[model samples]
Target: MPCHLILSKLADKCPSAVLAVLDSLVEPPQKTVNFKPKQDAVKQEVDHNEDMIRSALRAIASLNRISGGDCNLKFKSLMSEISKSPMLWDKYYSIRNE
Candidate 1:
């Protein structure tokens, strides 16, 4: 059977389960009001994030060149708290499942 037909049948059989799954699939809206951040703070943060990303990219590229293969991601500890936080974990799982 087609996937939508199967899902409809299952949802008909278990409306609550289907609703729960769908609710989980929906993303929460960003709470940042006036997302255009005020000049200095936003600029600083953007610059910092950009620098970190570039540093990581450089490290990965160098490793790949030296080893002739993809390098392992080595900073799980650095992001563990953020990824495991309640707010972020929910969004992370929702995005991954999608």
Candidate 2:
């Protein structure tokens, strides 16, 4: 099974674990000086990070829906992390709407 599916099932059986998993998945923003020579590599890394964050947000949304929104409190820290980037916040709301 996909990792997200496993996480969703785990969330159903143990909601508290969702927060811990999310904490691990949601990383704080990091500032690094990028050299022109590594711009492509940096862009690739940024894209990969965005994908991971989107996946994590989807998992959180699934958990919230499965728990009938009872899991909102557990998402406080995750949401804050998501809100730091406009792109992520938009993606999160779009996922929630879906």
- Indicate which candidate wins on lDDT: 2
User: TM-score of every model?
Assistant: 0.29, 0.50
Worst 10 residues of 2 by lDDT: 28-37
The TM-score that candidate 2 achieves is 0.50
Q: Write the per-residue lDDT of candidate 1 for residues 5-71, one digit (tens) a residue.
A: 4444544566555444443211111112102344667777776644443333333222223321222
Q: For model 2, what is the error of residue 69's alpha carbon versus the real structure, in angstroms, after optimal superposition?
A: 8.9
lDDT by residue (tens digit), candidate 2, 1-98: 15666676777787666655654533321111111233557877777656665666666666655443444453565556557868767887997788
Candidate 1 error regions (>4 Å) = 1-41, 68-98
Instruction: Assess the local accuracy of residue 41 in candidate 1 as a C-alpha lDDT between 0 and 100.
Output: 75
Which stretches in model 2 have alpha-carbon errors above 4 Å? 13-38, 42-50, 65-75
Taking all chains together, the TM-score of candidate 1 against the true structure is 0.29
Clashes of 1: 0
